[model samples]
Target: MAPAPSADTLGTSAARARSAVLEEQIREDPGRFRMLTGDRPTGRLHLGHYFGTLHNRVRLQDLGVETYVIIADYQVLTDRDVADTLTEHVEELVLDYLAIGVDPERSTIFTHSAIPALNQLMLPFLSLVSVAELSRNPTVKDEIAHSRQSAVSGLMFTYPVHQAADILFCKGNLVPVGQDQLPHLEITRTIARRFNDRYGNGGTVFPEPDALLSRAPLLLGTDGTKMSKSRRNAVALAADADETARLLKAAKTDSERHITYDPAGRPEVSSLLLLAALCQNRTPEEVADDIGSAGAAALKKTVTEAVNEYLAPLRARRAEYAQDRAYLHRTLREGNERARAVAETTLAQVRTAMKNHY
Candidate 1:
């Protein structure tokens, strides 16, 4: 007899299946879907974020999906010691969202700190999940390892539960995620399932959200490793044209005179090719073919030009938005009010379902 498929394999298979159906449904009637996705306000937004998820958020919103973006300011405390600059980071995030075509009129953008009822749901969600299960979450483990801290905080351990609340508080039924993040969504789905099974009273209070996997390949940093702000390999979306060219000038690439698109064999060269391809909406191979025998200098120049041109309009918009801090604040204020109202409704339903509506 054949051995059973592993749990990870089963999960991946199930996610792909659900995603196919979700895509078809979205095509037919996008307004029927509500998407929940966001970022931690730890640092400035970068190219990795733009291509990976930000662009997708804009596309979905344009397609008529109900979009909600949370700044996740509270999540930064999981590993960091202070939030003194938290306010600045939140405003910068809002600017980045608006500059990238995330219209406030269409998509709701709010911060975790602004939604009390949303955080309140965490208490009950915590009860539905176990300590062992939380500890077993791979994404949580990866975060803890990368944190390089000697001791882990209880809040850090319960990070996934909070994420579940972030999604379920607004009754979100669709979440855009990468493959690595599926574990976090799985726990969220589990919480939704257990909560409904225990307190649903034969009627579901929360919908189990499915993962809308990102189609974009991971864009690495200039140093030929993962694109990260701390690593200083990432290109910030707010970087000026001169700074962008200067950074690309020093990018890592092999000494081969001829360029080729072999990510596994020539990651450094291939990474630059991928960047140009993404900017031009062409394939990496096509970019590589165009730069044949031009060597690393020409490749770097091509990438810099592509990146600077692509980001010019976004950076222009960001600069304009930055000049008006009052508008940014007002946007947040309005988003928070809208999010709170939604959370209040969801919490009220939870109270009714659990027979605690007194």
Candidate 2:
């Protein structure tokens, strides 16, 4: 065996390895894989969510991969001081999923708070990870900085273990992730390997899942920072035509008159152009070239119109789904039941392997 790489090197290699592997396997036999991907139900998903993972999710499902999405309600409590809005956020997140083309029939969608069996796995999985390891995770560090809080909760620090439970509960072997999320997935892989080594009797009980990186462009916030709900810069996925226009119109732009795609030099202008490009399914350079010599006002107008037009059908469908609250409730209820059964089976195997089942 070769010597293990340094922490930084391992992080870089793992980020790219699974992505390359999945790209080859995807075209050959997508059905042979099981994928897990989802979001925290903190707010309505935005354009970043759409391009980031949602589109790849739909593609994987249509290609016959068994896919499971979690509206991670429990994760929201990590940094949040109140729980009053969680219920509302989870519901709106499901609507956003449906509006953006996540079919309940093809993909199983469940709330993290409802899955008892999955959460139970966290106990044994927690034992497999060390505090030193958890603290060293780059993603967690970045999250802490982003939270900008003096005190961080225990739940927030150990959320990656919970994430492992989320993936392994369904025996997921393919997780669609971005480069930024590779550390979390690496921890998941470590827990799986540790569990199998400790418990398996010549038969691996858990598979080390790999990352499937999407080529989707990351959309910056209107203020040129990372787009997020907490930042109050995100445009929700269900934003109506008028709402979309309003948000785009107010987005920050450069003082320069000419519109260009120089992200490093003119992030504000490039961010708007990037938004327009993604909405129109074109390159930022193409959009910039088309909008040649236009000022910030012209750039914002073009982006606002493009975004509103793109979200028009989604808003209409969301409105229809909103009217039938009962249907949404039923969809979630049925999905939770379906996901629980799978979690129970995996948990049963885990218990048997660990000699915890009596």
Candidate 3:
């Protein structure tokens, strides 16, 4: 009968404790962790995607973490009116993922709509979360404003619950997310805990996932604003050598000319340096020092060369995969089967816990 807790307070204490536990976990055995992360199939992935999470995803797979990448196709419909080109968008996304080292053999890559069981889990998860709590979700609020949509859909409002289903369906115990998305993960943790406390038979039904913060620096767009597909500031992974060069060369830089690693005072120049440093696995300050007195033009050239060279191998692999449409389809088919298998297991457990497994 009492009011549900505010969104901000959902999992603050648990998240903090989970962070600590994960920190110690990595020290002991990182392979024991399972992670889930992905993006909406809006368009081809850009440099922002690469530096933000893709690179870390590849490393996590190499380190032997059980990783799952979800192409959130349903989430894309929250604002999009016409999905006539959604098929093309999903295909392009798969190509980008494969091109950027998201190995299907090493990690499971499945589309959200493809896993029906995952969606079914959402019905129960909804009951564990409240409308007041969902309404206060910070990520949902920011997304609505960013998309410039005046009306909210039921699916959009209950997005965090869907996300909870995604994580819990895979039994994902670790999620690599940005600081801004902490609240979403907090909601996921709260749902998992609430379900366990209410329905779990003398034990927890779901393991609350913890946040694995990325160390990559945020990359601003060419215009010094947030890099996004709609803004046309992103450099897609599928871009050719020439296209990549053109995008980088045209990126904004201040008139003062000389390059420095002052993010606060010179964000444009600093953004370029950050890209170059991340590409070459060096520090931004070190890259800045290496290009001392070289001016903005020189810095742009350095960054362009590094980015093109860095993507050369990936682009080649992408080209090959893009041509083999059958292979891409097969990859998805296999991933969906694997993902559904896991989802079924988890869903069965959930139904049993809630006394609906008769």
Pick by TM-score: which candidate is best? 1
Predicted candidate 2 versus true structure: per-residue lDDT over 24-131, tens digit per residue: 888899888998988998778888888788878988888888889999999888887778988898889888878878899988989988899999999999999999
TM-score of each: 0.96, 0.94, 0.92
Q: Pick the candidate with the highest lDDT.
A: 1
TM accuracy, model 3:
0.92
Ranking the candidates on lDDT from highest down gives 1, 2, 3
Evaluated at residue 61, the lDDT of candidate 3 is 80
Off-target runs (Cα >4 Å) in candidate 2 are 1-10, 356-358
How large is the C-alpha RMSD of every model relative to the true structure? 1.8, 3.0, 4.4
Q: Model 1: runs farther than 4 Å from truth?
A: 1-6, 356-358
Residues 1-358, model 1: lDDT tens digits: 9999999889888887888888889989998899999999988999999998899999989989999999999999999888899998999899999999999998899999999999999999999988999989999999999884678888999999999999999999999998889999999999999998998877788999989986767888888889987688889999899999998999999988999999999998888899899999999999999989999999999999999999999999999999999999999999999999999999888888877423
Q: Over the full model, what C-alpha lDDT does candidate 3 score relative to the true structure? A: 0.86
Candidate 2: residue 168 Cα off by (Å):
0.2
TM-score (C-alpha, index-matched) for candidate 2:
0.94
